[model samples]
Target: MADNQYITIMLQSLHKKEKVLNSIIQINKRQKEELENPSLDPDDFDKTVEEKSELIEQLELLDNGFEKLYEKVREELQTNKELYKDEILQMQGSIRALAEKSMEIQAQEARNKQLMEQKFASVKKQVREIRSSQKVVNQYYKNMMKKGYVEPHFLDNKK
Candidate 1:
């Protein structure tokens, strides 16, 4: 599936782990509290024993439940590992595709750049030729004026 979906699933797994941890913590706390506040009424010793026995049975049940949860968590983690392997393979494929596309783009850009440089060089050569021709034309005009073949005009008629 998509990467975001995978992440969402992992987050849910982590939430489950958190809940299990909290339950375990709370159970341990209750057990500790009971141990510390044992019933002390001598006349109610039998009732207290019975109560303690029931508590012990409950604790055993809790322990069994925790064991089952632990096994389930382990199985889930293994499944996650397998799922992640597939995800990593998919990601690698995506990375490779992107890399290939990038390389193709870079090659196209390089070719375009080379073509531009060639065009620029051709234009520059044409400009240089034009400037050289202009210089030669200016020299020819100067020679004609010196030989009295042409006249120069002045723009002094502003009135």
Candidate 2:
């Protein structure tokens, strides 16, 4: 009876962890979109990152709880595999889904990284152009404002 209850609790925990992973995948997709936006909002992207962090922490907690429960019935479950076959199968499916979601997140984040690098390169080019133009303007001003003693020319009115 106790082992069955433990299996049920473990299944519930796995479901919660899988849900969090799915949410994180969605957030990563949203982040990719934000990066692609012409006018990217840093705050929004940062908020999503913060949200992802919290979810990751929740995942850790879920994992710890799940591990503790599994330890309680580890010997029994291992010996009586057929006893809780249905719950075990469901948990396996949840694990597979989590893995798929994790892969999706990695791919999305890789794309987002490329986009961020491109944006940074663009900003760098603009900064360099502005600085170059500023230097040219300063040089022009210096040349125009340069003061020196001018050679005097005496008028000769001898006819």
Residues forming the 10-long window of minimal summed lDDT in candidate 1: 31-40
In model 2, which range of ten residues has the least summed lDDT?
A: 142-151
Q: How large is the C-alpha RMSD of every model relative to the true structure?
A: 34.0, 6.2
TM-score quality measure for candidate 1: 0.40
TM-score of each: 0.40, 0.81
Q: Identify the runs in model 1 with alpha carbons over 4 angstroms from their true place.
A: 1-81, 147-159
- Tens digit of lDDT per residue, candidate 1, span 56-100? 465466445545544545455466767566644554564465456
- Per-residue CA lDDT of candidate 2, range 30-144, in tens? 8778877878777987898899899989989999999999899999988988987888899899888878987887888788889889988987998999999999998888778
The alpha-carbon deviation from the true structure for residue 141 of candidate 1, after best TM-score superposition, in angstroms, is: 1.8
Candidate 2 regions exceeding 4 Å error are: 147-159
Q: For candidate 1, what is the lDDT?
A: 0.52
